[model samples]
Target: MKSVQKIMPDMRHFEPLPDMDDRQFQQWNALLESRTGSTLPLERKTFLVTNLGMRMREIGCRSYDEYFSMLEGMEGLREWNILVDRITVHETRFFRHPMSLDLVKEYVDSKPHDVDTGKISMQVWSVACSTGEEAYSLAMVVDQAFKKRGDESYFGVTATDISPASLNTGRKGIYSERRIKEMDASLRKEYFTPLSQGEYEINEYLRKRICFARMNVLDIDKEPVGKMDIIYCQNLLIYFERSSRHDIVKNMARHLLPGGLLILGSGELLNLDCPELEKINNLRVLAYRRVKEPNKDQN
Candidate 1:
């Protein structure tokens, strides 16, 4: 047999692809919104281009039209899953917003003294939970709150995200030092154990209290977790259109138990008009409470 030489990529001739024009951009925008219910603004077109282009290069795609057509083709589901993962924002840290957790703690503290928490354990849903920080943080706070009260109250968290990649990280329950830096030292010590140098894992007991599932916010009708006592769907509405945001808020309200708490990103759902939800301002934090008789308006 004759020896053959392998071909290598011609690095010297390499160049990045051109940016998407207005028409091409709209095509991508429609695809993203149709799949995720997220609206990408004109100003953020470059962000769209960058993320899509990176995936394009990986798949050897030369133009948006061809990639888009492939996305709509029979094998598109697998490709769409990969592309959507890249597009969805996952920038987060351990206890990214302590102020938000504080509000959650306050709610737990206010639980009725005579209520049988043992029979009816508190349930929290961390929507769009990336890598488990926010979900685990909520668990830590709720657990600590009940422990300090010396009450039999128990709590569980159901964390959901659209990305399987993110959920896998949550299931692993390991985090780097930088991810835990912002967490309070006391809390860091109590709920997490140092696994190795500059890394930690959620305590086994706390890890067991959380269940992870894949969920698309756009498919609100198919929520995996049932009704919850508190729903943390924060920092996500800003990505949706005004009408869509209201719809999302309404869907979240529907998932709450009566008197359940619905927390949103500051100003994310401002002036939302949902008769079923009563808005509350706690120490300058805005939250919504599901009413006993929600006006039954279908969003």
Candidate 2:
């Protein structure tokens, strides 16, 4: 038989947050979907609620209903940014997926050598590039590949993300040691300068080649990023609905140069049927290429 004291639950650690009801959950789901193309399912509402509770406490909202009302208009738009920063996941590192980088290298090796004919060099875009790691990773790879080919021009990388905070970290090009320990040692030495404070700042050669921007996926259609040779948008679309995922990919494809590559996170979208995208299945690698430029008059 269990002891009476053990059987009785301790009253001390049972503090619970205000319960989020169905209507309130729906309101949050809709607002999130409209702003970020992401929907939190019913089962995931607890996670959403926890994050909301933190922000509500910071802003002194007593209830979830009060929080919902505060998330309303022009002023609410500013709050939305803070909310997004809290709720959205931004986990990334240098060469997060090595296989993807390898495939990109193969593609770069296949490109015609730069013959000083004043032809446009390669243009790579690291979409949703959190904290500049991916953008700098691309630069390092491209720089080494171009050098091995006896080519000297270091192509630029355009990195974009929805979180201004993430973009700000990326623009600084400084990273902690723990953040980069998994990176190749040789590459780390070659591309970064160690600081007295024990942080490593990306070398000027790689740093100057990247341009960071804050962009929401919904507004991508309006931006003229024009004709990228490689557009790497990985580990991002999983947060959105399947229909929205397809739309984002289609929009991204519009900016690809004819026959240029568009690489997504593995298994991100299966059986993708975009008319302009031709899926490439190569040696356990999944990627797509623009079949041809969309006609000027057609979207």
What 10-residue stretch in candidate 1 is worst by lDDT? 112-121
lDDT of 1 by residue, 26-143 (tens): 8888888988899788988878888888888887787888888998866898888777878888877766677888888888888775443344368999999977888998898899
Top candidate when judged by lDDT against the true structure = 2
Q: Rate the local accuracy (lDDT) of all candidates.
A: 0.83, 0.84
Whole-model lDDT, model 1: 0.83
For residue 47, model 1's alpha carbon misses the true position, in angstroms, by: 1.3
The CA lDDT at 66 in model 1 is: 88
TM-score per prediction, in order, is 0.89, 0.88
Off by over 4 Å in 2: 1-16, 113-120, 293-299
Q: C-alpha displacement of 81 in model 1, angstroms?
A: 1.4
Q: Which stretches of candidate 1 lie over 4 Å from their true place?
A: 1-14, 113-120, 294-299
How far in Å is the alpha carbon of 259 misplaced in model 2?
1.4
